[model samples]
Target: MQEEAYHIPVLLAECLEALQIDPAGTYVDCTFGGGGHSRAILDKLGPDGRLVAFDQDADAAQNLPDDPRVLFVPHNFRHLQRFLRLHKINSVNGVLADLGVSSHQFDEAERGFSIRFDADLDMRMDARSERTAAQLLQTYSEQQLHKLFEQYGEVTNARTLAKTIVTLRATMPMQTIQQFKAAIQGVVKGNPNKYLAQVFQALRIEVNDEMGALKQLLEQLPEVLVQGGRAAIITFHSLEDRLVKQFFKQGSFEPEEDHPFENKKQVSLLKVITKKPIVPTMEEQKRNSRSRSAKLRVAERI
Candidate 1:
């Protein structure tokens, strides 16, 4: 068997601590990339305790634990509630989600997740998925591309970037990372690699519907967690962290509505456990540059 690719867990100690582990309690690792967090949760679990893990990437299935106590669900974390129910689990004691593309996904150049490497324009986290970055570039309207780049990537020149793609794709589709990079040659600012990296990141986010999937995952948190059960979410981008932070605080994407007496009713779903996000230690950041962007937030069921 081929060795399973690995992703170094970010904020390892902090996540283990934030979980406030009950060795006899059941827990869930919603994003089991490389099984790092799942391994930790299992290590802390007693014989009676159970750990269920989920990952959309088929590549991660290799990391699934052989222990009977650890159940691996080969699906997206967005389907948390349904899968938990199917497994006969009504509610869990704790849930942990390490969101965004895994390091292994980026390191494998053929996945086209990293602009630093030349590869196909395929950025689907789940290979079974039909949509690829090139397909999105081929079909998405210029306005749609603009919105995707601006909203997902926070790209400063999204308008021009979108126009550039549409203009270039008219003659030939931007199918490879090299072609796409060449197309955007003029707009690249500061460092070429960094600028292309941001553009590729934007495309990958759009292709995967990452924000949509994240919203779905957040919506199901209230349903999956038992009373007092905590959820630890590790987000690598401001966009993902903002949604997690806001939902934990307000319980929904929409603003809390006022009652008849003009008082806003308290959202009973979750109590934000972390007033501020937990960040990586200086040592971890130095050892792994990927750890620098991670932000971990914890919340508990009310």
Candidate 2:
């Protein structure tokens, strides 16, 4: 199990440069998949520098580097502040989170994170999670499915797809990948591969509560990092990219409807570093197709 094979860190050099690593500064790798970025951060750190690496998926534990300067926490980055305080740290100099599923999760057939697989409809990033993708199909109402497909997957035929699932699941079993794909075969629109991938992406997002966790992590950034400390986040989809972009630009997930502070002004907490999101180069994308969708945005805590 090589580190690169587990997960090829996307925009590695860009992330390192974004962090602007200081030798004795403390940092956090919110999603320490393969420890790729963390390892690079360590290379620039002096002996006194510390890195707090967090990963909810147990699989990533194996890829963690054996270094005294690194402290591995087996928890989701949503608990970033708690974990940092528990370790007697007040603030970090920089934070990095690559919010993409690792290659290892997709490569393993049993993970159900890939569209190419025919395993159980279980796409839990953290295996300890009780809900599975199959359960969502079995339990979600038609409207719920429609909204999920429409908003999360942006499926053009979301309503029809939801109706189809609601109609079929009563008689047909979609407890596995093969069963689900076959069940929805007739309704697939556009490219078969791309359509199915979108559906799977929606399921994975809901099952793992990824967006919720990300919001929690972002909200903690201002409190956990020192002034001028950088936070570099790499997002894979537009939904995530938009969230990061908005937070960086305005320092809040604003413009929400009927919320308590919908119209209230929020003092900006972050100063945008990258005027535009950084995307992978052609050479990197050619080397790893998965990096194509990645967009890196950075901001400094104000």
Candidate 3:
């Protein structure tokens, strides 16, 4: 199958430019959704250059290119350091991670990522994972649900929604998207579609441990890259972007208040290349709606 057919590469040109690719230098694509960015990186590499791509989703393996230069790792990017060592690579010249769900996952009805679909509430990016959205909804405490919806989804009536879910689940099991939607219909504010999307986003993040994986990936950047190596990450939402921005500036996930001593450190691990994140152009946003929320941040190893 063609790469674009799986998931159109958002901010393709911008990501390639941000990497500052060296034809003979090794690179990594942390989220190889459809091999789109991997293919572009391969096109720029010399015979000796190597590219290691990671994706936890089993469906992604079908789109892998038959190129010896590319090494596709069928695991999450959170294990980046371990995998690189397994390949006998100490450091890479660049790393690119496009975080969040791919268009392919959202379009696939059985994945239950889209609100448009009435499939079972299974949102595990890696099918091997046991937890599903249904399981999360059924198990999480009201307080836990409230925090997830508020923090991850930014849902306006998160507390009320959580309460509603807890009350409804006793009599109505939310095993499918339609059942889950009907359960929360009363608390949905403003636009139903927008509200449901945010709710679904929160559930998906919780089930897949998206934030946890991203934190792990960020923590390993300094160890994974050589001096002057570039890391270009494209985040689809503010939470992910904020973490990337803070890590690039502070070399740690903790807030400046939490790590007051960080300011006095002699050397920082990463130097923020893009002072502000690079956003998609109007034309690009129009062409691909998913690119609208994407913010690309680039950093160089110091």
The local distance difference test score of each candidate is 0.86, 0.93, 0.92
In candidate 1, residue 126 scores what lDDT? Answer: 85
**Model 2 residue 204 distance off true place after TM-score fit, in angstroms:** 0.5
Per-candidate TM-scores read 0.95, 0.96, 0.97
Cα distance off (Å), candidate 1, residue 54: 0.5
lDDT of 3 by residue, 97-135 (tens): 999588899999999999998999999999999999999
Model 3 segments more than 4 A misplaced: 258-267
Where model 2 places Cα greater than 4 Å from the true spot, the runs are 256-264
User: Clashes in model 2: which pairs?
Assistant: none
Q: Which ten residues in a row have the lowest lDDT in candidate 2?
A: 255-264
Candidate number with the higher lDDT (2 or 3): 2
Best by lDDT: 2
Writing each residue's lDDT as its tens digit, candidate 1 over 209-272 gives: 8889889989888888888889999998888999999999988887677678887665758999
The lowest-lDDT stretch of 10 consecutive residues in candidate 3 is: 258-267
TM-score of 3: 0.97
Q: List the residue pairs that clash in candidate 1.
A: none
**Distance from true location, Cα of 102 in model 2, Å:** 0.5
**True-structure RMSD, every candidate:** 2.0, 2.3, 1.7
**lDDT score at residue 8, model 3, on the 0-100 scale:** 85
Ranking by TM-score: 3, 2, 1
